[model samples]
Target: MTRDANRPLRICMISYRSNPHCGGQGVYVRNLARALTDLGHHVEVVAGPPDPLLDSAAKLTMLDCLDLYNAENPFRTPTVRELKNPINLLEWLSISTMGYPEPETFGYRAYSHLKNRVHEFDIIHDNQSLSYGLWALSRLVPTVATIHHPITRDRQIAVRSVRSFWKKVKHLRWYSFIGMQKRVVRRLPKFITVSEFSKTDIHAEFDVPAERFHVVPNGINTELFYPLPHIEREPNRLIVTNSADQPLKGLYYLLQAVHAISKQREIRLTVIGTPKEGGGIEKLVKKLDLGHIIDFTGRVSNEEFREHYAKASIAVVPSVYEGFGLPVGEAMASGIPVISTTGGALPEVAGDAAMMVPPENPEALAEAICELLDNPEKAKELGEAGYKRVQEQFTWKNAAEQTVAAYREAIRDHRKI
Candidate 1:
């Protein structure tokens, strides 16, 4: 049956795991689902463990998973009853052997659940789960997989970050799922990504032609991340959103800059994430005597996020690579001046609204931070520009419309076959 272009489409948005508190994938799922539903399209979110918070207008279908990798209890063994299902058994075996199996296993689960109900929805939208089951689904119904960016970059950076031979081997083994993703993505025809940089990078890494990819930029939720006019911005106070110990986040460089600046003047740095106890970040803080200057707010609510941004003089995105650079957009939407690294798609998101610095360079970061702090007028100017940029360029309504176009294209492609 062909889709009616004038009528509202029924969409099955599938995500293997979605935790609404953090991570770009979960954030993407929540906002995009709401946006599509707001456009009068029927959106039903089918997700796994650690539920995603969605708008009341959107329906949610929860899927069961062992959730062995939950941060609270990492790698917990499942009971015999839980493992009775072959799919669960496979997931356990894969993780026990140091391989990430969520994509492949979740694909099987999604396929099992949706096989008989294929006609219930007009299309299936897979959020970066390029599993073999997604390929199977495309054969039955139109499928659009959003490859945020190639996971190959993560694997490469992770493998190189470690020193020991055994550590490098472990990283490689853990990311073995990339092999399946690469094969699965190459077979699929329709794709959606967040940026031009991601589209080109995915094409080179996944070997999917650029023409097959649709670039639909993610929208910043202004209601959740707008400037708090009542709160007074602090001076010589800096804030950054990052996972403290992740090598790809470039937090080490930001800390180095903070330490250097603290020696010359009194400055406070608030990190919107926690560091592992006895981790490298904790040790560095002790060695540099920066414990007094730096503060880490583990996980924060939306209100806390705005409060943090409202109190800060500047917001920094020190990531080495980001497919869409949500932090940059969020900071901009909050009406804060941003200093971002020239990594992956950061420049595409910042777009002259932010001060661009070279990635992994502490000196450049330090200079830029000092420049913004020293000139409040300049910082204010940038902040206004960024807010205007977000209003004019980024919105969930726009993203939802572009995504529908991509869905129609996928349907057309599937019908031709």
Candidate 2:
């Protein structure tokens, strides 16, 4: 088909926080916007807090909200000098006492600026902010939202894992924003989710009709995550990546499994994220007496991360819940066999290419690891299959094409109203 002579579509992608070091949403916004720009669309990412690592082709509009959630000092108190402004004080107090993540509050600030200049874009694509501001935007412009998955699942799993009833209460309080999210999602005209698993789960959890949801799988940056042909994998070496000390990640089970595996086999586990000096995960490592065999790499650059993936014999994703499992796909893209639990969409992401285990089951995880280690040929076959699967199904180009089509659909739907 020939290109349309009309000017390219202008798209504004919004995310409250897009720090690449922290989580998946940053990577989603960064890559999707770049891919859309490559497809001859004008893309601008309006974000709060840490900046997104965006391509030069895509413009970035930073909406500063004090960035209290940066990983370096996630909840550090602002100085009195910094909080002389009443609004800053309110933001700090609201987040500290109420436990609501600051993104929604920040989104309101971003939306205020964006609404005055809304004419610059043909569509507004929100990366799961689900704030009241987003609801307002739907009233003014062609708007669509990507609800990665229901946050309610995370709260449920986290609460279940906590032994203390008070801790569970705290978890519930922290995730109180879920009520707001469900309300916003139920009323939204169009919603985008990364996988069919997430699509169904969101519909069931948020009580939204399935027809209103659009399935758009996330893409992988194959160039950065490709296999290292020259690096030979060391035996009994494993890798897992997650934000440090997050209970929902199910790293505790993986740690237990690694300890069990080490009792029989000489094994080493490399955690791609840092653990606090005396945090729960670190304490667990010490208590289990497996500190000698486990290592935390803190934060590494993209190149170093790929090298870590290359050197590992296997990649384990033991998350209890994931809206989409990027590490599983990235490891697969790196031609490493994955041992992932059937947490949320992990089975959907891994499919038949990688081994699957039930979540929070160290015995099952250990058994799968032993099977892979004992049969190197099987592991190698799985790795190759995974690489092929990722190449065939997950790529930025595919995601971009589908996203553009979704944008068009959203625009057409908006026109009808």
Candidate 3:
């Protein structure tokens, strides 16, 4: 059956595991589902453990899977009953061997669940879960996969960050799912991605032609991220949203810059993520005597996060690479002056509104933050520019419209075949 362009489409969004606090993927699933439903689409998110939080407009169907990597229990063993299933056995073995088995297992579960209900939805949209099961589903339903960016690039960077031979082996093993992803990617015809940079990077890394990618940028939550003009912005308070120990986040360089600045002036840094105990960030903080000047808020509520940004003088996106820089857009939407590294798609998101710093350069970050702090007028100007840019360019409504167009196209193509 062909889709009616004028009518709302039924969409099944598949996310293997979505934890709002864990990363941007969860945020993407939650917000996009809400946006799509608001557009009058029948949206159902079929997700795994740490299931995403969604708007009341969208229906959520939670798929049970052994959540071995839950923060409370990392690599915990499953019960014999849970392991009775072949899929669960694979998950257990993969995690025991240091491989992330969620994607593969999630695919099996999602496919089994959705396979019988294929005719119930107009299309199946896979969110970065490029598994063989998705390929199987595509043969039955019009499948569109959004590869945020090639996981191979992430694996390469992760391996490069480690030095030990055994540790390198561990990194390689952990990211072994990339091999499965590559094969699954080749089989899908329709694709959606967040940015132009991601479209090109994903094509190059995954060898999927750029022509197949529909570039629908992710939107910033304007309601949650807008500037609070009533609140006085702190001159010495700098904030960054980063997963402290991740090598790709470039937090080490930011910490270095913070340490250097603290020596000359009484500046404080608020990290939105926790530093692993005795990890790289914690060690550097103690070594630089910056423990007194720094604070990690760990996981914060939306209200607290907005309040944190409202109190900051500068918001930094120190990531070395991003599929789409959520922090850049969020900071801009919050009306904060942003200093971002020209890594991956960051420049695409920041545009000319942000001070572009070279990735991994602490000196440049330090100088830029200091310059903005010293000239409040310049910082204010940039903040206003960023906010205006986001209003004009990045909104969830626009993204949802584009996504629906892509879905319609996929349905049309499926009918042709």
Cα RMSD for candidate 3? 1.6
lDDT of model 1, residue 100: 87
Residue-wise C-alpha lDDT for candidate 1, range 140-175, written one tens digit per residue: 999999988888988888788879999899889988
Off by over 4 Å in 2: 1-7, 72-76, 79-89
**Residue pairs whose backbone atoms clash in candidate 1:** none
Candidate 1 is scored at a TM of 0.97
lDDT of 2 by residue, 300-359 (tens): 988999899989999999998889988899999999999999988998889999999999
Backbone clash tally (model 3): 0
Q: By lDDT, highest first, what's the ranking? A: 1, 3, 2
Query: How are the candidates ranked when ordered by TM-score, highest leading?
Result: 3, 1, 2
TM-score result, candidate 3: 0.97
lDDT of 3: 0.89
